[model samples]
Target: MVKGEVCSEGLGPCDDTCNSKCTSKYPNGKGSCDSISNSCKCFYQCLQPKPEICNVGIGTCSTACNDQCCNGNCAAKFPGAYEGHGVCYNVGPSIYNYCVCIFKC
Candidate 1:
């Protein structure tokens, strides 16, 4: 049920400021929060691609995944669900227009 933009587990880098919740994952100056936006502030090196605003239908589809898939996109493949495994696929704009969840197994 996790929706919206998926955050990357990987931080910008040791040279960049990271999120407050995740600063301990990096060194001192490598992670901090911007008081205004209250978001992780990073040095220029941590710059990454912004999440894309896609549509449903053509870009629309649906899939489910485990914790591993929660943070990013996983290529479509498989015999579908295995055992208690969840599905992992793209969804539509109504439900979503991006990877909804990530998988671990």
Candidate 2:
């Protein structure tokens, strides 16, 4: 979640000082962490962060996404279990599949 406010003077281009853990996905000075403003924002772009706080009855509404979703929001669409073998098995109608025992049930 990049805040809209960014200090370009002291920080130099965001790319140069980008925090890898915080702002690695974007290039071109995007995903800047504004220490003064305490917010993060991508340059010339808009992206809503995942709803960390969900309203009543909303059950943590899925994250705003474009085309294909990833990370947080992905659980909303494909609920399943992956055993590190790159296999995902859907448990039921909702997200979150039961983990299968490696040995046996």
lDDT (10s digit) by residue, model 2, range 1-105 = 222322121234434345552344434344566554444534322223421111111122122422233333334422343111112223244243322211000
lDDT of 2 at 54: 13
Clashing pairs in model 2?
A: 2-40, 2-41, 3-39, 3-40, 3-41
- Candidate 1, residue 64: the lDDT equals 51
Candidate 1 lDDT score at position 59:
31
Best by lDDT: 1
TM-score of each: 0.22, 0.17
Looking at candidate 1, what is the lDDT of residue 9?
A: 43
Give the local distance difference test score of model 1. Answer: 0.33
Q: Best candidate per TM-score, number?
A: 1
Q: C-alpha displacement of 81 in model 2, angstroms?
A: 41
**C-alpha displacement of 104 in model 1, angstroms?**
1.9
